[model samples]
Target: MRVVIGEDSVLLREGLVRLLNTSGFEVLAALGDAETTLTAVEEHQPDLVVIDVRMPPSFTDEGLRAALVIRRQWPSIAVLVLSQYVEEQFASELLSGNTRGVGYLLKDRVADVGEFLAALRRVAEGGTALDPEVVAQILVRRRSAPLDRLTPREQEVLALMAEGRSNSAIAGALFITDSAVGKHVNNIFAKLGLPPADNDHRRVLAVLQYLNERPK
Candidate 1:
């Protein structure tokens, strides 16, 4: 997969290039700021963009906003956002609709090569990858009676789903196999009274339902 990287930290930027290259992904360009990253992405049109949630000029949500822009402008390109912290609101915004090829993961997740590569591949293949932390944060504030029926582990899986994570990413985060994660997802939907569609889109639907019930 060809990729464009966006991050302000020099070490992390170089490290990501090296890591993705070593893993057989082509690094089209490694940019230090979101502005250049956007330009590079538009010019090169890489298969995927791995960006930090926060980037230069503000160190806040510039990268996140840039990602939103990319999603709007280039809906076909995949995006994977890495952050030190997982904000529920940000996750919601990123996964606001049925947008595919999107990811929101914590920075620490980079240390797990298997997981990170899996996420990259998933996004590249037009799937979603989300950090378990983001999922936990969303679930913490939601008040769903059906969610109460799940076991803690199952709940964790459900939260990961809300964050747009795939079965493989959830398995990697939870230290389980993808098959086990699939079972957990099935149980979650069954407990929540959702149909057995087995589509990741259903996960987003479930999240939106929970978000709608919360007192925003």
Candidate 2:
């Protein structure tokens, strides 16, 4: 896949370039500021953009605004937003339109190569990949009855599910058998009123429910 990287940190930017290259991605350009990044996208029109949520000048939301503009102007290009902190509002904004080819992940997640690369590939292939931390934060303050219908374990499983984890991944993370995870998933879907469907459809439904719910 072809990619453009927009990050202000020198070390991180270089590291990302190396990582993507090593992972078989073609890095078109590694840029520092938002404007150059935007220009690069206009010029190269890469398949994906890996950008930090903050960048030069104000160092607060510049990269994010640029990313939003890129999505609006060049919707064909996938975007993966990396941030140190979880911004529910920012994540919601990126997901405001079609969730396809959009991602919001914590910078810390990059340390986990397997997870990070999987998220990147998913986004590049026109899928949603929100950070697990982001999902947890969004669902944290809610106390709705439908959600309450889910047991605590089910709730945890749903959170990871929203992060695009597979049944095996969830099982490994929670140190349980895959069959147990599968049961929890079915219960979650039933409790949330999600009918049987393909796993991706179910995932989108569950995530949309979590995103659309009002915090109590």
Candidate 3:
């Protein structure tokens, strides 16, 4: 797989390039800021882009803006943003289009090499891989009307789903059987009016709905 790295820190950039290369990914470019990342993408057309949340110039959200632009300009390429903070709003904005090929993982989570590589592969194949911490932060915020309708347990299940957990994983996390987790998932889906037909991105759709993305 061809990959691009967008990180301001030289050490982290080199580390990512080395890791990806060791894992058999061709590192087309290890860029410093969003501008160079964008330029590299245009020049290399890599299969996956691993970018940090902050970058040169403002160092606030330039990398995120570049990811958004990449999503708009070239939806085929996958984007996985590694951030130091949870930053739910920025993560939501990246997945705003409601399709796939996007991911947002916390920097600390990178220590788990197995999970990190799995998430990278998942996003590359057009799957959402939001960190569980990201989902928890989103639910930790203020509660709204529609969200108020869901029971606390259902809310917990929904949050796990938003984190890209499978039924078995949720079951393991919640200390329940897979059947029980499946039931909770179905109930949450039904209550949220999310069709079971499109199961792949249902978690993302459920999250977008919970955030009240629809026109008010």
- For all candidates in order, the CA lDDT equals 0.81, 0.83, 0.80
Residues 26-65, candidate 2, lDDT per residue (tens digit)?
Answer: 9999999999999999999999999988889888888888
lDDT of 1 at 10: 95
Candidate that scores best on lDDT: 2
Global local distance difference test of model 1: 0.81
Residue by residue across 3-112, what tens digits does model 1's lDDT show?
99998999989988998999989999999899999999999999999999888898988888888788878889999999998755556667765458999889876687
Instruction: Tell me how many clashing residue pairs each candidate has.
Output: 0, 0, 0
Error of 3 at 176 (Å): 55
TM-score of each: 0.65, 0.64, 0.65
Tens-place lDDT digits, model 3, residues 1-216: 899999999999998888888986899999999998999999999889999989999999999889888887888999999999976555655654645888998898788887888889998988989889877766553233366567888788877876778888888999999998878877766565444331246677677776664335
Rank all candidate structures by their lDDT, best first, as comma-separated numbers. 2, 1, 3
Better of 1 and 2 by TM-score: 1
Worst 10 residues of 1 by lDDT: 191-200
